[model samples]
Target: MFSYCTDPDTLSGFSWLSCYLTTGKHMAFYRAFGTVLLLLAITAPTALAFGFCGARAARSQVAPLRWFGKIYIAIVRGVPDIAFFLFFVIALDQAFEWLRHQVKCPDWDEPIRQGNDFVVCQIAKMPLGNAPQWVHETYGFFLAILTFAIVFGAFAANILYGAMNTVPHAQMETAEAYGMNRKQAFWRVMVPQMWVYALPGLSNLWMVLIKATPLLFLLGVEDIVYWARELGGSKTARFSDYPHPDWRMWYFLALLVFYLGFTKVSEVVLDRLMTRLTRGQATMGGEAQRKAAA
Candidate 1:
């Protein structure tokens, strides 16, 4: 905070507002935007990896693998995304601690689950009780990313699985006729064409993912929404550098603009990507490109 912030009551106009927005807490608030971006950066690729694995498994010749893949897609899709987010974070957290407890406190005889409380031996805590604050925050961020990956992975798998099916069987047969092995045919022939089909669904999923970033608050991460509430709430002289009336509506309006601008930019990028992927493919997009060039 500025020197003026030392006496918020005495300051007015831009001086007061500047001091208020630069408080230590407000700095944290500003950093929360980065938290959102970091989550997306880490989660998107992890989610894509998960989806790719699930899609490949679903198409595997092994019956067990196929069944497992199908079940994963079904269970995740059947539940509401928000419900899954709430449920999985808890389940996964407990699961990690439970496994740790088994390893770390095998000799302990007390029940881990008693009433509403879950007690694990001190060493079994995910970060251990003595772990630093940064460790705790990092662990929580990891779980949030995993939860997002699991949920969005299912959606991506469905899109990719359908895309795989949409690839012409004749193309596969032609690859075989040319003496290409199944794996070679898949990598060289099927994968390329599948993108032409997958991009639209993947684009929609990307938009949904952007919209869902606010759920980071539910995961207990101090995301942008969390900061918006903390900084925008009415502050009293007793609790703030520059006390002000509630301005949460204005804060949320800014968020609205941020998302709308981001999504529009994403649309433009995805459109360009679609055009590039569709080029020279036997699709309507390619046809249009050829006619335009003519």
Candidate 2:
């Protein structure tokens, strides 16, 4: 991308490597790594929020709300992730476009789904056909994030729902005896105690979520996996600057290291968090801390 790097064939040694690394596509590749991190950063909390709501709804007094929550959690958790990711991306995009078409082109009468093709009015396209490339990319990335949140949210809901139940029955009874109703007891007694039990399951989910980030490429997002293969594969003289032999093995090896390091760091942080949350609780962890002090 640099001015001096324009004539790549003439360059060699350090200059060739420098030019090759700074190409426009390579810059995009670097940004793709950041994109993966961004997806994880955004998805984790969003999924947690969704899971919290779903878990609460699953335990709701109202029948319809409880059914909705239970079904949402069941369907997502029951489906294989690869199937869900592949299907949801297309389903979500079409669902958005279908809604847009209903609002924007109500007079246009045609089967939205005709045989294999899912069609919408031109103006109703999710990003609009005339939108910039970046807009299209952004829309795809946002959709991937939503799909991920929905899937992981269900997983979290199942874990949290169980965790809520795992809290001692005595605690809820004590709260009720102290003039707290079911609603008050749940918020005051059950919710706080659920986290210690929830931590272990959620920790596993966090690691799985980290591993699943590579699926961004499957969702049509230009993610790190896409770039790793693109940049690392052998490039002929006509195709790329500073042509290289196959290096995908090395590229993926780096990815392996990145994930392992990330998982290690997550384990350390979660262990400390679990210790803090378990303090003074009736669990074994809490009992040990109590004994240590005594």
Top TM-score model: 1
Runs in model 2 lying further than 4 Å from the true structure: 1-19
Which stretch of 10 consecutive residues in model 1 shows the poorest summed lDDT? 1-10
Instruction: Report lDDT per candidate.
Output: 0.90, 0.90
Clashing pairs in 2: none
In candidate 1, what are the lDDT values of residues 1-294, reduced to their tens digit?
556567767888888779877888879887888888888889888888899889999999999999989987787755678999999899999999999999989999999999999999999999888889999999999999999999999888988999999998899999999999999999999997898899999999899999999999999988889889988899887876577899999989988998999899999999999989988988888999999999
List, in order, the clash count of every candidate structure: 0, 0
Could you tell me how far off, in angstroms, the CA of residue 128 lies in candidate 1 after the best superposition? 0.3
Q: Assess every candidate by TM-score.
A: 0.95, 0.91
Question: After superposition, which runs of candidate 1 have C-alpha atoms over 4 Å from their true positions?
Answer: 1-7
Backbone clashes in model 1, listed as residue pairs: none
Cα lDDT tens digits, model 2, 153-173, are 999999999999898888898
